[model samples]
Target chain A: MLDHITQTTLLLDEEKCRQNIAMMADKAARNHIRLRPHFKTHQSVQVGEWFREQGATGITVSSLKMARYFAANGWTDILVAIPVNIREMELVNELAAKVQLHLVAVNIETVQALAEALQRPVNIWLKIDTGYHRTGILPHSHEELDAIVALVEQNDMLQFTGVLAHDGHTYKQTDAEAIRTIHHTTVFLLNLVRDRYKGRFPELKVSIGDTPSCSILQTITGVDEIRPGNYVFYDLTQQHIGSCNFNQIAVCMACPIIAKHPERNEIIVHGGSVHFSKDSLMGANGSLIFGRVVELSENGWSEPLEGIEVVSLSQEHGTIRASKALFDRYKIGDLMGVLPVHSCLTADVMGSYTTLDGKRLEHLSGMGQL
Target chain B: MLDHITQTTLLLDEEKCRQNIAMMADKAARNHIRLRPHFKTHQSVQVGEWFREQGATGITVSSLKMARYFAANGWTDILVAIPVNIREMELVNELAAKVQLHLVAVNIETVQALAEALQRPVNIWLKIDTGYHRTGILPHSHEELDAIVALVEQNDMLQFTGVLAHDGHTYKQTDAEAIRTIHHTTVFLLNLVRDRYKGRFPELKVSIGDTPSCSILQTITGVDEIRPGNYVFYDLTQQHIGSCNFNQIAVCMACPIIAKHPERNEIIVHGGSVHFSKDSLMGANGSLIFGRVVELSENGWSEPLEGIEVVSLSQEHGTIRASKALFDRYKIGDLMGVLPVHSCLTADVMGSYTTLDGKRLEHLSGMGQL
Candidate 1:
């Protein structure tokens, strides 16, 4: 695989990815929770089939475009996790007619617009703000919540399904106990909202997701559905947040060495911000690290090298600060595997991937005009 | 145009872009230096035509793939600015056979590999390190320099063109004087290297490039050609570096408003890392700013909003902390124009563009299987 790479290529380890899927699936099965994993991480139809084999019947995406792509490829059920944009009502109507389209709303105006514009039935999930503060209405804002729910109930095309919240604050925690605490608090808050509406809507469910909380917690208590996405291809940020071990990382960028500066113990590779998005994590020494370096082998890659790290990235160049030993071991034209800091962003940037067995996988972004 | 955008769309102001091109071309003409603008910023064939109208006949790209994209579109003289990756010799041979391919080298091993692998003649430029210290041999390293030059001299397929250096260190400065100082020092050092081999290679040329220096310096001395790319799409980063004014910025992302948070004074838009990228600038209050917000008009976007700025970004959402006036001026479903921090990365991530006149411009990445 290394010999065949002529440029920066995203390499996927299928065995490890499957193991991650099975592990998350088994956890959801043991807790009797529906595992509607988010498809935004991999965004590959071939990888989505693996989830179907593991009994995942529904999926979550971040945009209407992505949901439409998955729907065209035979995915019948999808939950768009972001707040619905009313301007895309034509697309919304088209998708609603084709699949079990689940849309999210945090404001009454959007609900009113959807009620007026929809030509087909769709499930509406109230995007509640648990604590992330990025988007969503506060769970305790009953006036606003009741208005949106009442509008949804009045519309024949809109069905009030449940409440969903993404505890994205888990990404800021580096301790397992802290992640668990945040997860428990989020579930408790989400249950409060569900309990408030149980008298009117008895079958209302709770959906929550975030890789850190999902990967560290032993069991999910209150949520009826889990939508963890990044666990499928956990990255260096996940490792730093204590979500997954280094060996569980499923993707690595194969970048060819383009230049070497032994005097400064720096190696330049063809990978850069274009290949790996500019997401970063603080290193052990308090410096910024773009990615972790690994040695590539025939089957896959080894563990992260001890003292080698990607320090900076330009548009098409990555400067890796390496230890003397590692710098001497590699030369120009050799391939080095770099575990990205954020797998979802990296996969989105690369647009396609090649498996270790030399099979090519397609992504939605790579398919133009989708 | 605003009504036509259903999702995040990159908006290009063609008038501003062409004016930027003409301004730089005029500066190069006045200084008696050739203008081989970098094509990596816009990566559009139509935009390259604008440069051709401005009398630019040569171009520079960051990768072999990009060079091929332009070469197929009738760009005959192309330079791949990064150090040559020997693993891509097949692409090198293909490009060398098609156009006046110019490749850069920092070491002897790559030159030796090029000497052995080439079936066509190619111009080789010795990439020198004046001060940027990213990837290049120091200009004072005479022994290493002489070795690579002598090897290039011995190979019939190699034509030693000259010395090329990118003073990327200019990007770190926020003052015009500091940028000019760095530009002068870089030119002095590049001239010293050119003078060292002047007797042997009498026609050797010197080249230097960086948008901040190229835009701010009053006079350029001792360089045969200038290659600044980002000036074509001056971004918020260039404005912060004192390179170009805010009005000269040619591109802005048109993102639809999805959610609004009145309590926190935050507006969530359908733009994030996947659209605008994660490159940031330090804000006035010491917070990291992903991009600057502007009002979208029918003609084009307004100047940067005084107190509204993008504070945080996720995979598909941008959280903007807005002033009370700006927050109340818009609502969900309205469009906001965001000037990106780094236009090159943003353009590469967006993959396509929509001009103010509603014409769609294609990008190389958007054309799959390049």
Candidate 2:
């Protein structure tokens, strides 16, 4: 193996990562809520240990592979964030047998399907659509909830744990007040359902997610647990929405400039969509830059550089057009640090992470999904 | 291990891949020229092996990692198509020692940098910018050529092998005549310098590359070799430019539809920028879909069903929006085959390959440039 590697690899600052974890854990502690931070952002076992150390026992994952990966590495509490598919019941049963696996049910049909397919008991959280028109049951759909509750009662293995709402729309908030409004509406809907079900079912769990809410909100009343994955590696998108400071961004992929074209004012980078991710988070100037152009140092994730736009990206090549008029900005032999538009995607493609101080850490230990 | 594993992997038809190789090889053979297909598109040993099987001796790669990957995989004659950087002299030396590596030098500075760095003799190909202004030495720069030639004569290790040009602008060609025009202009520029130094340097080589001209044009006169990589995996872009027909397209990454929103006429897929690559190829209705969603069968890549466009892509998820007319056409759980606008970037992400018949193959053997 080559000893001195020059290729710009994904550098993880363990200290910064732990600090981000501590901040989230502290936030949850202050709010008196359970902190089941999403592990999908940093799928490394080494990175996960940081959260596990900071008093986080439960975690969220996007897929079955991630659930299995973490469970094998001693993470007993794993929540498969997507709506549970009846097709994956066998794997879910196997995973639940190994540990405490919580899942989401967005539709009554899927709840019925899960009831019919599951041979063992599985904790199921009913997903409510507060505002994000992406996934989950509509908040006004009383008929749908009644049907799902009816289906859950029929199956001994199926348990309705709580009403889960992922306020993903909060990330699109333009201002703090917009985010605040999203949280207010989210909490209001949960309380409306919680009050109705309290006398009949006092064990109902109310869980809220979405990094922007979990990161910015000082308190989360009526919510039992908060799952925010991207807090560990805050990105440009998070920064735009004022979720976390630029200094708190923990993980960044180091990319090298392969070719610098002065005529077009563009520089081709080795890190492309495959590595840096094709996430378009444009700025006020209408300049397109999917990920932030950061600087690298001996210690950890560096400060963000201005007047640099990652204008366009090909598969394995990123095309950055310098906004700076100075020609001495970058050359063929320079390495640029990139903070992604969203850390969730950035951390996913890298597969593994190493510290800025040259500490190689194995992170692909227990991914809920691969 | 599971009895059978299925994932969203690149499906490269070995037969078609070889056929493309043979077609290009035959074109070179008829013209009494050399064939050098660029390996940047399908960075696979198996694909390279197929090229070799079809009589390809020289292959082009964009990065040192790719050059190393192909060199280690038994490709004796390889060309690193990217311009030489002074910082990567050590890697160039190691690569030059391993094989008959042909490095591209765009200017007097790069050529001079190469001579001073490499202790051993390295075959240098002078990259000329005839039109598409990305990289390469200006075609009409006599001062630059004089400086390059002066250094080459002084330093024996800096041997001038050939003049190479990439007619990527041919991709924008509208008709068969436009392709011929691009071919004529490209050959005109390569011939311009070759004739200038014909008697001065008898052993100088001349080559022009781009899949559009190599795949379409029947003639190769002044040009001595070809390095068209995208021809192997014909994309929608190629099909649009009339470079290759849809039937000739070999690779397709089959993505899974995880969620279907019938009201919105949108289907969320498992493949995103991480799988299908973020390339914009125009759809049938003039809408820009990142890729063409095809009709996938249990057997192989098939004809694309009408009106399935991958409207948007996130890191791990692609939002394929079909027309309301198409919603009733495709089912909820059906797999959709997406044709990448750029095949190379899409293939590199999954780090592996699959066949039309759903067989697995590994492509990424080691780390690429940072």
Candidate 3:
């Protein structure tokens, strides 16, 4: 399998990925919640089949283009997890005509526009802000929330589903306890909103999604659905956030060593921002680390190598700072595996993946649709 | 043109791009050096034709894949700027058979491998390190350099073209004076190496490439060729480095405003790291800015908006921290133009571009070959 890679390739360990999916599925089952795993991480129909094998019927995506891609591939229910773009209402009508399309709304104007333009009935999820102030209506913004809900209820083409909150603030936490606390607080606030509207709308549910909280919490209460994407290919950022162990990471970038600099103890690989992205993590010694290095093998990769980390990246060159012992272990023409700091951005940049068994998987971006 | 953008779309100003190309071409002609502009920034056949209109025949790329992409489209002299990846020797041979392939070598073993594997003649450029501690052989490493050059001289199929160095340290400089100083010092070091090797190889030339050096320095000396790629699409990073002004930026991402949050003075756009990339610039007030925001129009865009910047980015969402006036100036469903921090990575991720006059341009990645 390693011999099949001649350039920079993204390697996915299928068994490890399956194990992660099973673990998350079992957790969601034990908590008595629906598992609508986000498809934005892998963005592959093959990986979506794995979720189907785990009895997942509903999925979540980040954009209308992704929702349409999955819907065309036989996914019936899809919750686009971002605010509805009114400029793309034509796509919304097309998608709503085929599948159980779920769109999120944070403002009354967007909901009214959807109600006026949507040709078919679609589920509407009010995007609520628990702690992450990125883009969501606050839980206490009763007037705005009421206005959006009233607009959804007044239209025949709209069905009010529930409230969804993405506790993106959990990513900033460094430990499991903090992540769990944030998760609980988000769930409590979302449930409060659901209860407030349950008398008028009895089918109101609470949905929360974030990798850190979903991976660390044992019993997720007060949430009707769980949507965690990054756990399928946990990366260095998740490991640093104490969400998952290093062994659970299923994706690695296999790069060919192109140049070596012994004077500065740096090795240049053919992988850079084009392959691993410009996302980085600050090392313990106060330097930015682009990725964690690992030793590649026939089957997969070994544990993270000690004292070897990708320090910087250009357009098509990655500079790895290695220790003396690690530097001498490899030379030009060798393949090195690197666990990316953020898997989603890396996967989006790579656009495709090669399994450990040498099977190629296509992504939504690689489908030539844009 | 702005009405055609329904999502995150990369918009190119063809006139500005041609002006940039002509400016660089004029600079190279006046300095009496060849301009082999790197095509890695805009990996498009249409953009290549524009450069050809400016009398650019030789081109530089970062990988063999790009070299093949351009070679198949009728480019004759192509140089792979990074060091040779020995794993893709078969590709090297295939490209060598089609064009005047120039491969960079930083070690003796690579040159030896190339000598044994090539089925046809090829040009070789010894990568020299001046001050950027990235991937290059030191100028003072005469013993190793002599061995590599001797091997290239011994091989009948190998033509030692010259010594090429990418003074990437110029990117760290903040002003024109520092960039010019680094350019002059790199030229001095490359001349020293050429003078040392000119005793055996009288036709040895010197080559250096860095956008800062190429855009700032008025008079280039001691170099036979200049290969600057980023000048064709100068970005916010280049503007911050005093290499180009905001008006000279040839590309801008047209993203739809999806959500607004006046409480936090933030606006959410459809563009994110997948569109603008995670590259950032440190603001004067000690914040990281992902991009500079501007107003989009029918023909093009306006100057950078004052007191408005993209403060953070997610996978599919960009958070713009705007001033009160800027926040209220526009509403959701309008289009906003963002000048990217790094245009190369942004272009690589976008995979295509839409001209201001509503023409679609195809890119290498968007060709669906991978």
lDDT of 1 by residue, A1-370 (tens): 6798999999999999999999999999999999899999999999999999999899999999999889999999999999998889999999999999999999888898898899999999998898888998898899998888888888899988899899899999998888888888888888888898889888898999898998998778898999999999999999989999999999999999999998899999999999999999998889999999998997999999999999999999999999899899998899989999999999988989899999999877776641
For candidate 2, the iRMS in Å is: 5.1
Give a tens-digit lDDT track for model 2, residues A123-207. 8887887887666677777877778777887788887788888887887785888998898899889877766666767898788
Q: Candidate 2's residue-wise lDDT over B1-370, tens digit each? A: 1112234556777677777778888888999998888888777787777788778888888778778888898988888877764566788888889899888776565676777778778888888888877666677888877788778878888778888888877877759788888789988998888887778788888887788888888877877788888888788888888988877888887664556666578776667665665668666668787877776665556656566777877555677878888776654334567877777667666667767655666556223222
Evaluate residue B357 in candidate 2 and report its C-alpha lDDT on the 0 to 100 scale: 56
**Measured with DockQ on alpha carbons, how good is candidate 1?**
0.73
Write the residue-wise lDDT of candidate 3 on A242-269 in tens digits. Answer: 9998999999999999988887789999
Query: Chain B alone: TM-score in each candidate?
Result: 0.99, 0.93, 0.99
lDDT of 3 by residue, B180-285 (tens): 8889899999999999989888999899999999999899988999999999999999999999999999999988888999898999999999887789999999
Give the TM-score of chain B in candidate 3. Answer: 0.99
Work out the TM-score per prediction: 0.99, 0.89, 0.99
Native contacts retained by candidate 2: 0.14
lDDT of 3 at B107: 82
- Evaluated against the true structure, the overall lDDT of model 1 is 0.92
